[model samples]
Target: MSIQRVVAVVQDGAEPFGLGAICEVWAEPYHPDDDNPVFDFTVCTEHPGVVTGRAGFDLVVEHGLEAMADADLVCISPKHDFDHHAPAVVEAVREAHERGAWIFAHCSSSFLLGQAGLLDGRRCTTHWRYAEQLQRAFPKALVDPDVLYVEDDRIVTGAGSAAGIDAALHLLRRHFGAKVAATAARRIVVPPHRDGGQAQFVRAPVREHEAETLAPLLAWISGHLDESLTVERLARRAHMSPRTFARRFRDETGTTPLQWITNQRVALAEELLENSDLGVEQIAQRAGFGNGATLRHHFTRVRGIAPLAYRRRFTCIESA
Candidate 1:
């Protein structure tokens, strides 16, 4: 199979890290002599040659708009200001979208794509600081202000500079398998993926009365996950009926008690997998999975990998 073609647009007053991120993902040769190449990337400018960056330096690009003709993917990094978008740059962005290219924009670059009407009716994101401006400019676009990135089909937008790496890795995971994406992540020293969306980092929700009462019960349940943690056992610990405990758990955590415990167990299992030299069965027992087979099933469901394989990939214990 042939490599995918990607054209990254460069402009005056561009953020160095933002632009470098796009280039790194699409152009930098990480794996040499690979049978299948990742991407054939070209840096293009509205004017071929010198373009000033946000840090007050000029970068030279030999390719121009013609580079987009063969591009399967087009990435636009943050330029100066939305109001200063060059006509040629906007038109090229529009034309590339019209020709069925998967478009990606990092940081404020989404503003230019929004200006070109490419983000109309599409869910997208930009840097959190400028998210309000982008929303105000393009009311038709669904602007997710809290996300690190939003994947709206062929149009992908990332927030901030480092978040671009996350977005790019997500794109890699979409195109390639999880293993390939994981390999790419190791090469770049970034997280393989972040689950549960960006909502986890926003302001915490206020807990209700019953949930507040479950604190001690929650601590006890966490400590004894190895034992059979049935609803009856938890209810007895909390001095409540099983039905009431279940209802209260759901209301307080916005999820069932069982689900919350499962998440905690999976997280503990991941920590052991990464830090301890324990066998899968040992880790499974400590994390309340009972056995390796049970652990494998739940680990795959939550972490997208088998227990041993995950350990082999992420284990990093330092012997003192």
Candidate 2:
């Protein structure tokens, strides 16, 4: 579906960066020669005047909730209180969903979609910290906290903060194709697509003793991601039994050693894709994926895009 008209609904305690993400992607007009689609974007609120943000600043929003009625895409920016939302805002979101307009919720705004009863029986996501609360509050929604965003039908829910950019660019990619989306991403100076899910960003609770013990091992592993790193090898390096090291690693890093190494390899591949002219086969070998096919397998699983496609969209060299 074509998304020509867009509206971002904000309220008191709304985060500026989340709201700004929407504005940056949809509202800003890029050069026409760049083949970028121009959206008729508006920022609306229930009380159209001054909306205070969590950062102790105010935004002068002139449009009211009614503006969303004509929008092809309606976005909900993160607000402070998920339990208490303005009735009009909730109703507007519900009405928009019913009318088949695309609904994009940033960060905690998924709670607003839940309040509107739109998330029921759908897969959605929010910030990892709030994922449990959202799932508990809305038992019908299948919440996947590990993803950067989730698209169930027309409703799109993004994880915390900057994932809003990922969600917005994804919608643009769907509607305008990868080339146009890449143009927009280039204008913003961000990779056209980022690899991996929110699992890499979720902060794990660190046990003091385990953290102190694993600090050196973790540092060494990060620097040598290209090497074949097994639990046995890591345990030997740390001077502990494999069983004991596995338990301690989980306690400190919240992930298995193999999984951590795979994540790091994917990160390294991402850097090489964006910065180098190397082919997928070469990148895979450099990133310790063994071959192109293996790299494609893991890269697709983690980044939701293939290695070559990601390179085409994000490669920095003009000749690439």
Quote each prediction's TM-score: 0.64, 0.66
Global lDDT of model 1: 0.76
- What lDDT would each prediction earn against the true structure? 0.76, 0.83
Candidate 1 per-residue lDDT over residues 267-308, each given as its tens digit: 677767666788888888999989888888887886567767
CA shift of 287, model 2, Å: 17
Predicted structure with the largest lDDT when compared to the true one: 2
Angstrom error at residue 174, model 1: 0.6
Please give, for residues 94-209, the per-residue lDDT of candidate 2 as tens digits. Answer: 99888989999999999999988998999999998999999999999999887788887899999888788988887886666556767888988886764224342624454467
Clashing pairs in 1: none
